[model samples]
Target: MEGLEIGLNGNLVDAETQQEGGRFFAADASSSNYILLQCKDVLTLEQKEELKRLHVTLLSYPAYNTYYCRYEPTELDEIRALPYINYANIYRPEFVTEAGLKDKLENSDEGHQPPEEKRYEVYISLHEDHRNRLEQIRQKIIQVLGIDPELVNADAFILRAKLQSHEIARVAGIDEVQRIEEIPRLALSNNHARVDLNLEYIIGAANSRLVVGGGLGQIIAIADTGVDDQHEALRGRVRVIEGSRNTDARGHGTHVAASAIGSGNSLEFGPIQGTAPFATVLSHVIVDNAGNITWSPLMFQRAYNREYGARIHSNSYNVSHAGIFQQRQYDGLAQDCDRMAICLPQLVILFSAGNSAPFKNVTSDGEIESQAAAKNVITVGACESTRPMTRNPLTYDYYVAVPIPGYLALNLAGNRDQMALFSSRGPTKNTNGGPDDRRIKPDVVAPGTVIYSAKSSQLDLTLPNILPGAIEAGVPNDGRWSYMNGTSMSTPLVAGCCATIRGRIALQCHNLARIPSVLVKAILINGTKWMVGTNQDSQGFGRVNLAKSMVCFSNHLGCGFWPKQESDFARMQMIQGQELKIRVPLPTANPYPDGITPRFSLTVTMCYLDYPDQSGLVDHLSLKVLQKTRLPDGTFPERYGNKLPGEPADNRNNVQKVIWDGISAPAPFQHPDPFRIYVRVERLARDAQFLHHFALAWHVEEMSRGDAQFDFWNERMPSTDARNRFMRKD
Candidate 1:
């Protein structure tokens, strides 16, 4: 009433709410399509059609002069206003207001406060030619918010409406509102049966038994607590998801869908595969069997009907801790699962990082959980392998339908590559509220202790409190197996080693569906064995090597990308210190001239995906390296005179990485230079594109011999179709 304010289009506009925090929503890049409200006003054109039926456009009737912003834009800080100027730009301050919300909205009551009906759910973002006038604005949002223009959804451009609360200011002053709020009420979701091939020999990939023909035409999914697809290591593979409920009755989604892509056609044990056992499972029950989890009903029930292909989901489940900051409702469901992984380009979502026991990198054990500490989901964590769990064969008589408990065991004692004191450590430091959630994360690590795979003889194979009489209670079991540990078995061994590195880039670089899950998460965190010196919050950017991420994606040795843009300004560029460079050339087909500085060992990574925007604008982007050799008295390499060596005017980290490790060689070849790799996409917060698509990944190698040497370069990969045209590398 008085100075109004509830304007996320629940009407009652005229500005007042910005005293400290935007009650429901608030934006300001010096006001883009204006939004600021205070509600319960003096209204009714059915409350302005319930503020245009909860999709509120621009609301300002008279009380338009209220500005108190020190920033309130979200969906993960793309941070804008550097000079969209207004509130006297004091050192570039966006907006900050108080003075007791301007003397309690200029001293209250311009009348009418009784008329509540409460029922909201909202999340509208329309305006793409108003989605072809969404059923004529869904019959004026059901004749002014009575709720039933078939519940108005507009199927994603963000629109989730449910109305009431006085029909939300008659649907927030619509002109096809580009933003609306309220939708964070998640209801939510483990592991073990084996160390899964001793976690494929602790991430070295079972010493190259590399069945490299991994899950072709990929498809993971698995959500959880339901995958029992007639388990004999999932003989019929599995699909479910349609209306979910394909029953698992708590066998824990058929042993986490046979530990990510299992299909060892079950005898119950030999090589207990999965980790993309020829990938393709979908599953997706969302924790039933009394585990009770609910992520927007299976992400809008498998996005209602169809269209979800290119996936890798596998979220070993965790939530209900919700503390260490970062929550735009789990970063708006991780920016809608990173807009379906940049629109499904080898999509990978993964999520574990929460066995929640140990913690470091400057304290706090209760941090990285929920949607696995959100922000574009990779998470993972849980290293293992000192080798111990090997039980199950006292003259074994393997399952001819179920009987042999023989020695009935599943050991995996933990000690190998270490770091599994429950595995869940990371700097994650606060996101969705962005700026600096520090980022490190469990981007790697694998082999959950005591691992084994596929088990769903249908409940009770154990767990009524570990080994208490080692199971027998009505065991009908079919293709049953055993063992269990955490970081939910190291996130499906990095989602089945990203489907065997996208099945070796679709069998030797034919370009496995254009390989890209951030360049297979930067070639598995730059082919980690440990990002060269651990404790990046307990070994992230380490472990999970998958045979050095399939020989660095078959010798392209760490990829790079920006590719997929066809609109909204193609290459989405906005470089500041300018330099999108690349020069990773060391194994130049063995061209001698060991001319120093070629001791090799580098790791890159870069990662990108942002555009749910609220505006923080320029988020730091960096990665530097320069060596252009020469000097042993031959002149040429100068320390950044015009810039190169560690060049940077900007660097904050979207997912940055840079390690050297070794550097000795230098005896000189009179004129041998070239090691450059500058990428710095700096811009504090001016905007033109808050990093649209980046995926850089690199690896240089040669680290002082004892086996750190990966690709001495050139091992045979490229083989395109229609008779050859592949030659493309930068």
Candidate 2:
């Protein structure tokens, strides 16, 4: 016991408990013992085994050198007496609250319950390994707090319960509880979207039999208020996975659902086509009639549901006040989404970056909060539409214009090149509670201003906070089609694009399982047309273009999932310094029109689902394309993902891209050189046992005639509708 220090505390200590000298003292042994144990060094396997032998269970080590321990109160002193221990203090839930809240709770009137609205409904996350003990902990909390039994809902890793201000601290003191977060009431956010995204061109190509299908035989899952499955455009293809289609009274979800896969005509407009007009939609109604929403896990429940067969999930809603607790809260929806991604590696999840741009208190002009800040999710933002608004010509400008004092507003969403005023921006705020972290958010943007799509028949179009005489619905009297705007419109459109790509892969690769989510993500991002003047924080990797993305895939080397030798993709476990190389052949020179100077660009993208951690990224790999031949200057030409040659490698993001463009037509014809793709792991999660997995996709393009080449490639490629495991059997 040379360097050991021990103190005592139990589950029922109230505000009156003294906080002197790193101790809270002990009470009765009615509940399990939870001690915040800290040590100078990380505990060894033998040391951990010794504690287990003493009947003490180590819960989790979130940050610092501290470990959460559960044991009988009698064994506290005995464990503290062990040689490796430093300080074993009582776990104080009150310490988690902000300084202001601590003061308010500590100095408040006794027997006082916070206001109804202030009594937050929160999800208490338990230690990952303690999931089986969730019910036991919840029952203990119910017995101790005497709360109504109906208010709690338990899952594999979380317990959802409504708690008053004082009860938050008491719940945190539970032995198995890891963290708590207030459930956010998500708001709807969506589109001249089809034209802006070049969906019309892709659809036309597919009709000509130039491509496999425009998202044909694919499924996209939308988790929103609800979808109007009976709507003319979405009637046959839309299936309700959670809530009924008739429940969409807000019209937001119906409009969003249509933006992705709607296939019929609008009442006013001739044809209201979605990005993926042929793709099926699975609707998960997350919002209730009273406008309340479930916690994060329930919001994305269907991503892994085999019956839904939805590999792509598009959510157009986000927390009302975005970024307020983003940096401070590590156990919020963002963490939940990250954990979900780890569990379901093939699921592609997209979230709206929120419509909180006008409020400085919400955005702080930089971070997007909650699920939008999740590392594994593709956070989407809004860009102005190129086509004119149908109902009100300048509605985009009117809603986004500077508002009267005390209200949130900004002037940014009019021009096609500019970002929408209400679209949240990002250089995501790191989790301040743990390690330093930051990543570029709003992964991509699409035209989201004054978009027309299917509207719920039962929806009441009237909403608040509008200009005195402005119209609420874009189409004044049309019952079937309505126009709306926001990242919500853009998100589903992107999801449709993902479905299109994934669908094509499923059809093209006859022998594989579902195309890896990372492969599709890489291909979509790799083909992006970078907005020359804008930075990554606002526009991400630029707009999603189907024409450009289709051309990004190799014409010769096939891209397929794992276990298929015909596929160009590779998925392997990598450790620090472990490097894998792939040789991506460029398209052979093709005869072009006389005056055109043909240019070729080789783009490579790699993505991996990393282990979840406090520091946004748990695993990182660097992508670089190396040329075989050395230049006359004795330096071999190389391009790092998103970086110029000779710069240091990027360590920030999980998705990486390297584009080697502008090679003269003669070089490929003369040399036929293949870009040497190198993927190397830089680091792994703390608990990761030496290895992590990743997927890599590469393509070579003839930039001078990209569309012509896209059509040509599709015409030559074999076409079939090979549905994967996620396809609905019912």
**Model 2, residue 317: displacement in angstroms?**
0.8
Candidate 1 displacement at residue 245 in angstroms = 18
Mark the 10 consecutive residues where model 2 has the least summed lDDT: 721-730
Error of 2 at 454 (Å): 1.1
Instruction: Provide the clashing-pair count of each candidate structure.
Output: 62, 6
**lDDT, candidate 1, 1-730, per-residue tens:** 2332212212232222332243423333333334333233223234334434434432222122222122223211122221221111101111211122223233434355532444455555444346456556767777766666656665434556676544544455553454455554432223232332223332232224434565666777777767778766677767776687766655656766787777664343345566567777777676544455656523633532347564567777665434433322223344455445545545667778766542223357334643565545588877764434334321112111245342224222455466755566765543222133245566777776555566666565333322211122112123366555667666776787776665655555442334556656766666667534456677766776555544444334323333322341234365444556665554333332233134555566666654333211124456665566656887543232112354643232355566655545542222233556665555423233444555665655544343543333322322222112221110
Model 1 worst lDDT window (10 residues): 88-97
Cα lDDT tens digits for candidate 2, 1-730: 2222221110122222422233454442335456666655556556767877987676654433446666665546676567777656555554433333344445656456534335567777775567678788889889988988877878645788888776878887766675666566665553357767765553233333423476898888888778777878888898887444455776778878888998886556677778888898888877766555554565455556777778888888777643333332334577778777766666788888876665334436374777888777888888878765444335434443445464432433456667776677777764433234567777788877777777677775454422121145254456567667778788988888888887867766686564666767776776676666666777877777665566543344422222233343344655456777876554355344346565666767777666544435545678888876669999778887768878877767777777776756656554455467888766543433333346666665545544323222222333322111111111
Stretches > 4 Å off in candidate 2: 1-118, 202-212, 242-245, 322-331, 359-365, 390-402, 405-414, 433-436, 461-470, 476-479, 553-571, 587-599, 631-635, 664-673, 686-693, 702-730
